[model samples]
Target chain A: MSNKKNALWHLPLIIIGIIALLPVIFMISNSFKTLQESYQSILSVIPNKPTIDNYTTLNHQVNLVRLVWNTFFMATLVTVGKLFTGLLAAYAFRYYQFKHKNLIYLLFVATIFVPFTIVMIPNYLVIAKLNLLNSVIGVALPQLCDATGIMIFLKTMEKIPGSLFDSLKIDNIPNRRIFFNIVLPILKPSIISVGAMFFINSWNEYVWPTLILKDKSSFTLPLALQNYISSEGGTNFPLAMALSSIMIVVPLIIYLIFQRYILNSISNSGLK
Target chain B: MHNNKKILPFLYLMPTGILLTIFMIIPIIYTFYLSFFDWNLIAPTKDFVGMRNYIEVFTDPVNQKVLMNTFFYIILLLVLNFIVPYVISLVVKFFIKRMQGAYKIIFFIPSLFSLVVGAMIFSWLLNPVSGPVAFLFRESGFVLPNWTNSGGLAIIVICLITNWKVFGYNFILLLTGLGSIPKNIVDATTVDRIPKWRMIWNIVLPMNKSIAIYVLILTIVQGLQYVFTPINVITTGGPYYGSSNVLYHTYLNAFVLYKTGNASALAITTFLIFLVLLYLEIKFVEGRSRYE
Candidate 1:
């Protein structure tokens, strides 16, 4: 009976797995096809004559290296910044109690729900006033201190017993050492989880970057690709697919490297 | 030593308080201040709008429609967001424990694509002529709606694109929740001869309430902003402005129309709605946690 039930469950898993992978397979296959072949049939899973012309074209027009660099630089900066700030804040919230602690924590948590649109205009105003418009800093600034990251870190820190802190104090370890030498080591999974999330979010972020960085020189991968599409028109499906393939490939590599850490963090953080 | 130790906690907390106050708290207060003014990029003088913008936004038929459309999209996307991914996650969790990592990577790849890139790709796929979707319908002997141009279909297509982009992340989140369930509980249910479906329905789902609520809140909040890109790229909130959401409407007001005050008003309203929802969620979760 258990075997039959297990078999029934496995059937859906196999089917959904295929469905989940279908678009990616479709994308990669079409990326190598000529534009003519892409339109011949929507259901075409294999290219008739695969070519690298689409990739070559994208490489030339999109300035792929610079775009990738900008994306990586911005994503890394934002991720690191958010991690530091979030960790510090979480540490503070977890290990310390002060006036209006709960109230302040609630306020920070409240910002998580403040739609980016609501803050976009004012944030732009501030960025503009600071003369940071059209720069990577402008694009990465608002994301540097995420409320969700802080909350995740706080939750993770809460899991650590208070006795650890007391013991650290007894050993005459300073608060700074307690944070760095003890708290941070145990918070590694949470940091990895939050860092991966922030990295992916910053890497994939479009609207804010598009709005903030109007200069072509500072364009991230997504913005650069969008410009390529708008300028060239949407007829070059193969080229677009090639660019899409590159976009997916980069993050997929990161995710693969950090898959276990990411999963562990997600599960442990209670963020699921 | 005890008094000095008490002071250390405050010292530890001071940096975060300062940073939050300077960055987040101050900016939110500034947002409130900006919402009351009529200002533009090119203009030197700022006029005190005195609730005029809010009144105009509330009274405008277009704004009303956009508000309704925002709610409609949220409701529709929420259903897709929860149901499809939850079911897929449950199925994936049930089987393929050994190959779960590979399955997760495959599912999450789309979510890693930039929203603009995803939007552009889908926009191409949904192109009326010389597009794959159209060609497929033709081959299948079925009519294809002009997805990006047709009013109702455009929204549905956008929803589908969002579903494709987000379902993997949702699935991973659900999988994470499922992973945390103690194996002994499941073993007990099995040893008692309880049916698997009944066990999942009666046991697993109930145990994952916090995760479920977290996902729900994130989906609703994220879905509101998701409308911004598609509305910008594909329709520009067109076909008699059917696709105009609150976010898109605010974008149009500020960028296109140069009505900064009206845009700010719209933004304020959007912020308030989500804030209220979040407050209720926090209350609900906290209350439940206490009860448990």
Candidate 2:
């Protein structure tokens, strides 16, 4: 009798889950459909006539290869920059004490609350003044100030045994060697978790890249997609669906493979 | 050698600090300064406008609609993403014991992609002419409106899409929160043969307060900005700028219109509003957790 009660709730779960998956199912199905089929068979869960016409058209029209490459380049640079800055800053906050250390640390933490919109205009102006507009460096430079990663790494670093640090110190080990040899090894998991998050976030970043990158040739996937969407409409549903799939496929695969680490990183820092 | 130790910490902090100071702190301060000036993006000079830009933001009809849209979006997210998802997760946690991992992965799939991509997919699905939802409505003998073209309804449609993309992340967070609740507490209460609803009311809800507040703040933050994707992708904040929120409005003002002064003013106002909401959250919600 009680088992029936438990099983009854599964109805809601199944219903919501189907609703959640509907968009993906629709997008994929629409991507496969030809233009006429997509319009006529709109309610069809499966494409009546599957074709690769949309992808071919998109590839021909907008240099999909270059957009993907630019996105990868920007995301990679931002990830590396965040990792380096996060590790160094976390090391400083965790290992050392200095005058006004609390103040300086507070300054870093305070940026967490300040929305990026507040600073975007001035940063754009600064980039414009330096003539870095339409460049990848300008797109990625301002985003490298990542306080969340520093916070996450520092919190993880705190859990490391104090005795290990003392033992290394007793041997009169140089700071650089200790960081490279011991600290880096111990921080590997966190690095992966944090780095993957940084990578995912950078991949999805839109506003900053849009602001900084103005040239069509230099555009990231998102900027390129935005441009396409604005210029195109429902007449090009298959093309839009195709581009959406391409944009989604990368991060979806990455998340599925490294789901545990991404979830861990988010829950680890996000809740607290 | 002893003096070098005093500066070692500074050396370690230099890279991140320099980046933060240059890109974050200085620009934030510069935003405040820029808000006071009437400057166009291409202009060589900024006229001292005092509080005129701020006054203009409060007085502007477009900004007023932008503010309403932002609030409406946030309320819808709180309902769609928070209240509804929380209930669903509780049911999933307590009753549906089998295939938990599959459920989490399936639900979280939407969040793996960018909001922009999700927006694109949804715009196609919610398309009035040949989209599936409209097709279903038509099959059912009702004419569905063009959602993106409508004024008030566009915000609702955008929120629905935003929730579809985001609720999974929040669902997992709530599931984690539920998981964090001590099993012993629930087991202890169950010995009295108390009803499940009462047990949930007295035990589960109270224990889950902190995570609830965290999710609330997160929802507010995401809601304020999440509409930007759909507004840009699907509507372009058109149909009389119906779906445009403050963030998108600010973007249009600065980048499209080149009204840097107005954009900066709106940005500052948005930040302050966020601060006030955060403060209230801490004061009310965070304070309640102390009794636990």
Off by over 4 Å in 2: A99-106, A232-234, B277-292
lDDT of 2 by residue, A137-190 (tens): 888888775877887788788888868888887898999998999889888878
lDDT string for model 1 (B163-269, tens) is: 77887778888888887889999889889999878989999999878787778887888887886777776788987778888888888887788888888888889
Indicate the residue-level lDDT of A162 in model 1.
Answer: 80
Candidate 1 lDDT tens digits, A135-190: 88888876767777877787787789988777776888887777888889988877
Q: lDDT tens string, model 2, B1-292?
A: 6787778878878888788888887887888898999888788898999999999888888888888877787888899989988898788776676977777878887876677877777776777876677878998999889776776888888888888888888888888888888898878877988877888888898988877887877787767677788787778787887888888888898889988999999999988887876665556444533211
Which is the leading candidate under TM-score?
2
The alpha-carbon lDDT assigned to residue B138 of candidate 1 equals: 94
TM-score of model 2 (CA atoms): 0.93
lDDT of 1 at A99: 66
User: Which docking category, incorrect, acceptable, medium or high, applies to candidate 2?
Assistant: medium
Q: Residue B22 of candidate 1: its Cα lDDT?
A: 57
Q: Chain A TM-scores, one per candidate?
A: 0.92, 0.93
Model 1: DockQ score: 0.51
* Pairs in steric clash, model 1: none
